[model samples]
Target: MSRSCSFSLCAHDWSAYQLAEQLGRGVAELWPSADRGRYAVLNRLAELGYVATRQELTGKRARTIYSITPAGREALAAWLGTPPRPPSVEFEGMVRVLLADQGSLDDLRATLQQTRESALANRDMFARYAAYISATGGTFPERRHLFALANTFMIGHYDHILPWTEWAEQQIADWPDTVTPASTNEAQVRDMLAPGREVWEHDHPDGA
Candidate 1:
């Protein structure tokens, strides 16, 4: 599961639509999938008793608004007191590594090359964002933090992935001509039971 932080404001003082937009932009600048991701965070907050929704009358249509409860504020304060864990990242290259033997060595090499290119592209994008932040006079603390975090994440990814991709490619290039499949054993077990007791045994009949 992914960890996220949620903050709620007073519904009476704020519009849900506007709040959604602000949060969407704030999260998008820092993370991927802004709207969906922020909504997910809000929804989780609601479940945690941090936010409650109410219907508001507006001319022709009713609008939904969200408010933060006292409990929510306390929860947020407590969360702030704790150190935040870095977000989790998933890489498809790991799956390729696990199934490396299923494909040709040349194909593996191509995949590794593509992975390297993608990582480099990401690094460049983060660098550009960092430069943009610096050029803008660094006026917005939030934006500065967002860009810095993004830059850090991208650099860390490149540092780890570049070496890993190179190693994977080299391994493929030097792979043996033939790979022998390891032997698999299947056995059946019979349980002994006392006169009045029943014995239990669990096994895959097909030995999958």
Candidate 2:
């Protein structure tokens, strides 16, 4: 399977490379160059009759195309019904912030700037994706509603990132250094806790 399989999908036929691209670009990180594991899973699915594979020649090369069987759809539906684990973040910039005392304030500021820039770029990317889907009607027009929901979640994630980085930057600007003893901003802390506190108070009024 190659990454450049085809831009078009014939029914539900998908190459292993295509699946890797979808997973990586959408939500997960899958390296196409080291795709032995992905191919193994696909092969296993074929063995279980969840997916069927066919060889098709594209020019001088033959590619393996896979289509989900009824069993595969059933498996997918069942998986979807299960509760997913909470989202986990693997951001190097956040790690740097967590260890900011080990580094200079300059380093922390730079990391914050980089994080904000990345969030901005991701926001633009999602905007373009939404616009493209709106204009060209998307690759799967039948699944437009699902796509919109996914896009909203992705956009919301970046939206949260941008504001958080901005807020962190503002806080850092008032700090003399990463290690120096600084007084806490009580107002800021209270503001940050307001929403949760309000919810808690509403749930348990008058300490009841």
Candidate 3:
């Protein structure tokens, strides 16, 4: 089947109205990162032939329900063949590190300490989520197979980052106060960056 749109958010064997509510709920949870205008986007998909719309009456009101066409499903399958983009992170902590030289070493150290705390707290939250997953393996009972992969990756991501942030904070602590606009020399720059390697080694002894 040929599709005019690249793909639609419609699910197999589901109507547009059914999908709209579910997708809206999902996007609400994703909030800032995910687009919130799902109804308009789904209408666009319908217009593009990636989705077919059907009207159904509920009480006195009519609802538009969307479902994937054969062409739409084919397009989605083709999309699966395309390579994904590289992961992008919007980390403020990294921004601080990039500009760490501007402020006093103490200030930068404090920033890194905050980053470490944030990462640790997030890691703890991930741990709690992990336990919840283990405890209730059948809650909601939808898409567990796919959600498992997502949750596992998220937990591991936080797990690795916590230690890494701990290392970064340690490095900032060991950083010299003299390097705070005291001199313009290669040795001072090296002093600020190089000594951190040992701290990193200490944090990541296995060295991956």
Q: In order, what lDDT does every prediction score?
A: 0.59, 0.71, 0.59
Per-residue alpha-carbon lDDT of candidate 2 for residues 40-68, written as tens digits (9 for 90 to 100)? 67777777777778999989999998887
My TM-score estimates for the predictions, one after another, are: 0.53, 0.77, 0.57
Question: Which scores better on TM-score, 2 or 3?
Answer: 2
Expressed as tens digits, the lDDT of each residue in 1-208 for candidate 3 is 1221222243343454444444433222223243345446666666767777778878998876667777777778887789965777767777877776676677777777787777677666656655766778633345556556756776676677777767766544544663544354557457767768888989999997
How far residue 80's Cα lies from its native spot in candidate 2, in Å, is 2.1
Q: Which lDDT value does model 1 have at 5?
A: 33
Instruction: Kindly report which residue stretches of model 3 are placed more than 4 angstroms away from their true locations once superposed.
Output: 1-40, 53-65, 103-142, 174-208
Off by over 4 Å in 2: 1-11, 29-40, 181-208
Q: Which 10-residue span in candidate 2 carries the lowest summed lDDT?
A: 1-10
- The candidate with the higher lDDT, 1 or 2, is 2
Deviation (Å) of 6 in candidate 1? 2.5
Residue-by-residue lDDT tens digits, candidate 1, 7-99: 326323346566665554334434554445545566776787977778898998898677777887777678779988688555676677557
The model with the greatest TM-score is: 2
The deviation in Å at residue 152 for candidate 1 is: 2.7
10 in model 3: Cα distance from truth in Å?
Answer: 5.2
